[model samples]
Target: MPIFIDIGAAYPNDNRVTLVVWGEHYDDFAEMINAVDHGNAWLSVTSYLEVYEGSLQMNSDNGCDYTWWTGVG
Candidate 1:
């Protein structure tokens, strides 16, 4: 089954923006990077849909995970 990674942005004023991103569909990572680089903070991932072999999988037991890195060195 294919996995998905949903991403989002949030604000300090309790504003939360969400986005749904599919796994293996990161052909536009550059755009996402640019968006975050422009001062947009990620809020949280709402949910994801599982897929497999170019098809949606119903009984997939996979889940999403996240990792963060500080840009400052």
Candidate 2:
């Protein structure tokens, strides 16, 4: 089965963010996120939406949400 990860932003606030990594193996998803170094960014988990598998989706009320899904063909 193909693995999948769904990450979504909960609130508009920078602190009220949510990051979820789901896939056939949780470790893979976690590793991907950790590799990105998301902690360096100013935006919190709730600032955008990210999905790994096919495409990446990002939404923000402040007009600064950015998401990039690499290694997808």
Candidate 3:
């Protein structure tokens, strides 16, 4: 199964983005980067994380719920 995330959820209902991820990237995330728009918001495997952008993570905790940056120079 893919992951699901809500972006800009606090904004107007129509402004919200529901992201789904099966592998590397999320649906709109690619659009923001000028890539093809598909699937939901994606997550880098914990192994790919260089920095965790969120306060909580860990597979036991809702399966890696949080944000992260990978391969930062």
- Residue 28 in model 1: shift from native, Å? 2.8
lDDT of 1 by residue, 1-73 (tens): 2232223323322222233344454443435544545553452332354444444322213343333333423
TM-score per prediction, in order, is: 0.25, 0.23, 0.25
RMSD of 2: 11.9
Off by over 4 Å in 3: 10-12, 23-73
Model 2 off-target regions past 4 Å? 1-14, 23-31, 36-38, 42-73
Clashing pairs in 3: 19-40, 19-41, 20-40, 20-41, 26-40, 26-41, 26-42, 27-40
lDDT of 1: 0.36
Alpha carbon deviation, residue 47, candidate 2 (Å) = 11
- The stretch of ten residues in a row with the least summed lDDT in candidate 1 is 9-18
Which sequence of candidate numbers ranks them by lDDT, best first?
2, 1, 3
Q: Candidate 3's C-alpha lDDT?
A: 0.35
Q: Please report, in order, the local distance difference test score of every candidate based on alpha carbons.
A: 0.36, 0.39, 0.35
In every candidate, how many clashes are there? 4, 1, 8
| TM-score-better candidate, 2 vs 3 | 3
